[model samples]
Target: MPRLEEITPDNVSAAVDIKVGPEQEAFVAPVVTSLAEAYASRRTAWPRLVYDDDRAVAFVMGNFDPDNETEAFRCGIWRLNVDRAEQGKGYGRFAVLAFCEEARRRGHRRVTVLWEQGEGGPEAFYLRLGFRPTGEVLFGETVGELLL
Candidate 1:
């Protein structure tokens, strides 16, 4: 089984390198760096690295917050990436589950994720994991939410 650990600046390089293929590599690098900076600025955000033994295989970054209007605490699954070489081994699912559990422990009542339409990407994967579309789109991405 893969283990999830908190991401630190020291391991960000390895995390960036784990992205699979040229297309993914281009998209992942800048986003990971931005997420890292966001996490650093927002200390309450959760950022994690998934590792198989000593090799870093994936990453997830998000945060928990209480919706003022709804008065419900919710978790956001902002960014998730599993190394190309490590894809299809169930590692991504396990990592997300672990993150959800952590969010629950932190008092979140639900978790949400957003995915853009088109191309090879996470929309189908998030759907497979039981996340329902909100029927709302933002910045060209579909928003999805799942009750914990």
Candidate 2:
């Protein structure tokens, strides 16, 4: 079974090593960048590693700033990267559902996600998980929301 692990000194290297395929490169930022962003926004960013046994297979960052100026930033997934080899084993879904459950625990009623449109972007994956476009586009990325 897969489980979420908080980023720590011991597993930081493994988290940074997670990478997606070349086709998905343009859609998601690197885990290192997300880590840096998490540092800058430490109060609001909830970043974690998806581990299957002892192997870190993905990185997911959730933003939980209920008072953020932007609606999409209120309570949502800011970045998700499933390692190239670990794409289809349901790790991505597990991470997202985990985030949604976290959001609910935080008293949030919805979870948002942003996705760029491209050949191998994550729009379809988000949709498949019951996230529908919120009909708002920010910086050319479609805003998606899943009600919790």
Give the Cα lDDT of each candidate: 0.73, 0.95
Model 1 stretches astray by more than 4 angstroms: 25-31, 67-74
Task: Give the backbone clash total of model 2.
Answer: 0
lDDT of 1 by residue, 25-107 (tens): 53344446756666575854677789989989888777665543432224777677887888889888987899889888888
* lDDT top scorer: 2
RMSD of each: 2.8, 0.6
Q: Evaluate residue 25 in candidate 2 and report its C-alpha lDDT on the 0 to 100 scale.
A: 91
Off by over 4 Å in 2: none
Query: What does the lDDT read for residue 34 in candidate 1?
Result: 52
